[model samples]
Target: MASTEETKTAQVRIQLTTRYPDIELPDDPGPLLVSTGFRRYALSTLVNNLLQTERPVPFEFLINGQFLRTSIDEFLTANGISAETTLTVEYVRALIPPLHVSSYEHDDWISSVDVLSGSSPAVREAEEVSSGQERILSGGYDGLFRMWNMSNEVIATSNAPDEGGHTLAIKSVKFISPQKIASSSMDRTIRVWDYSEESATLTPTLELYGHKSSVDSIAVHSQSSRILSSSSDRSVGLWTTKKSEAPSAPENLIPKARNKRRKLSHPTPSKTGTQRGPLSLLTGHTDVVSSAIFSPTDHTVGYSASWDHTIRTWDLTTSACVDTRTTAHPLLSLAAMNGANLLAAGTSARHITMIDPRASATTIAAMTLRGHTNGVVSLAADPDSPYGLVSGSHDGTCRVWDIRSVRPGVGEVGGGQVGESVYVIPREILKEKGKSKAPVGGEGLKVFGVCWDKHVGIVSVGEDKRVQVNKAGDIIRT
Candidate 1:
């Protein structure tokens, strides 16, 4: 018998095309080229070898005087010949040419989430220090302003006499120093407390009573000792502490109820009386001033949001109104981000608007966020990450948003135009689903305030009358 290699003789064929008019080729080439009684064997031997080696096969094949480089896979797929089809080497080469092949895979998603504590507090506000530590200060119908340690434990609590019982309750609290805390109450006074000793003692440091109505909010300048307070009287007052020889008296600057309930007619100058008053009254809002805050980067610049349906920026140095933008709805909360150049304002309309103070104070609706179902009452910015912001709403939840993702470029989107929302953290909804059925403590949990701690992530307080600490991916129990 003949040797196996010699017995398995492979067929080889070739064909040339030069504009042939009358030629009938095989209906199914099957890796073979046949035309006008001419049979061309396929080139399967070289193709099989190249495919097995996982390499490209570059071979020149002639067809009608034109040369081309094609791959065996492409030639087979194009000719309706599948893997099961077997053809000789010459027939494959005559029917198709060898070529190079490239393949690619699809892109995948790489994003994740982190849930934190929730709140349903009547009022809440937080302040971060030059140090990385954060101070969460909040109050509600409970009539007490509680300060929590970074661990979410109540480090100190400031409460007035039960007789006083915080008549209107503590609306807001701020930290002027690590040992000093300032708060405004519905009782129409601003009290400063000192934590110098082991125990936290409440001292009536300053009685800012120019406003005839309840004091709504207060903000301390990062650089100066000046304090800015807004009130239901629709006025902003700037206060400065001074040392006096005689003992100071705590007095209600407002007149008795018999007198007209109008705002204080005469301005109260600083103690020297020679210099203008430390409390500069800004009078432009038609309605109550909902919130006021100093610029994080520039002490001379301040911002205020009001129920008057407008947001105003102030040049504190000149004590003049810098610019104002009227909104269709009342602004309930305001926060500054991106080194104080970006201002985020949440409205009663359940929409958040971001404004570039560096710009012409134009409203950038594109960057607006609309996730809260109810009115937003509180707004806080992440001190460590200016692009990160947390907002608390009467809707009983706090939303965390990443400002950077809202737009493509940095300066301003579409020349002061707003970009769409990027990310939102529905903290309240998450907490409700995670709560235990049986109450372990005296009262159930509810979130009142939401704040970002540089080291601890987000800290919050609620009607549950407890402070809860939350990191991005996990919730830290105090």
Candidate 2:
């Protein structure tokens, strides 16, 4: 007996195209007989199957110029696509380096999961607590510190004068602990906030004032209870999480020295008024200190960058500069790689330089990364990735870089170098009243701060007066 079995298949026509106008595709591939019950399948599979390529690299898919993230059958029905209707799927290359070294393939770096905007002032600095992903803290030029969550809602904000808030612009913010956060300000003070999750309260607990000028940046120890702050006073100050026992004492200001001086003194009481001073002071730079960050591996070592065009390594315990290297440009930001034996810094000239911590002590930068058209303002190492890093710049963009794939500087022809950006924050058009406004250049959206979470989620605050949350997708290896 001959039994005839019937096969059920759905038909779809795949079209390969790109966003660029000049990118022309080959002839349209014919129909594909796919299973109707298909749930989740790789977009590369469909592209390769239709293109007749033996191997295919990763690419994002769109249906009729609309981006699609689901399986073929589901995407077909949800969009009211019929089996007889040809599915116009377009593909675009993944911009980031195929992360092959990290045992994971990285995606979603080109786009953000959420864009948050409420306040109108540009954010100057921001921080995300790695232990908890919900809370995000940001400082703005409006002299405000705001806290928000994943829902694009402002959780709490410090805009009131009665809450022990800053009377001037907040410069930087860092988490002292999971429950406590500290912020430095242009007002020459650092305010510690006690945040409560259960009651949804974040209020100032105490204030620390030591720097004679505006405090620009701050760093917190990973394994200890210490905090490091840099200031326009051209000095780095070290303090602790403990509040001062005496509140009414005045600052015993240090005498101005002409030569390089590294000294540690007990936190002197403020002479101008009752305030907390730095427990130890590190002075060497001839100009404003832009950034200071603790080594991820060693808590005792701190790195500080300054407008003096030099990066100095500090022995926090001895209050001495162990090493210093002059840079080609004024260094503005820094990030310490935990285990790769490397560190990165952003410069005023729009360059990001990666150096061997052991080798940077005596020589020039090992390699320079070029991408942002404007000065780089912030840098952050991906905590989960072995060689991944992120940078924010005055060009109004955030880019991810992989140390393993950085092009060597052998092609320098004019005593200068050039590099490419892997992924860029896509330019979006503002939509109002059901009509899309003309696209505006990102020059006004200068990124001031960027941070990564334990899950590799990215959050960036920019001069656009916006906060963006970037959540990565599966690591798809080509």
Candidate number achieving the greatest lDDT relative to the actual structure: 2
Q: Evaluated with TM-score, which candidate comes out highest? A: 2
Q: How would you encode candidate 1's per-residue C-alpha lDDT over 1-478 as one tens digit per residue?
A: 2233432342223332222222213232334332211211133333334335353333223332222223334433334544344433321122121111111111111010111122211112452233324445566544566655444455555655432234556666766655566667677766655554356455444445556677767877534667788888888767764434222332346323332476535433322222223357788989989888887777778889899988788888677887887767888778778554777888887778776766564444436666676677667777555556777665545566655433233454234333333234333323456843313221233233455544445555554443444454322111
Error of 2 at 296 (Å): 0.6
lDDT score, candidate 1, position 154: 53
lDDT of 2 at 100: 15
**Considering summed lDDT, which 10 consecutive residues are worst modelled in model 1?**
103-112
Superposition error at 44 for model 2 (Å)? 9.7
In order, the Cα lDDT scores of the candidates are 0.52, 0.63
TM-score of 1: 0.58
Superposed by TM-score, candidate 1 places the C-alpha of residue 212 at a distance from the truth, in angstroms, of 1.4
Give all TM-scores, in the order shown.
Answer: 0.58, 0.65
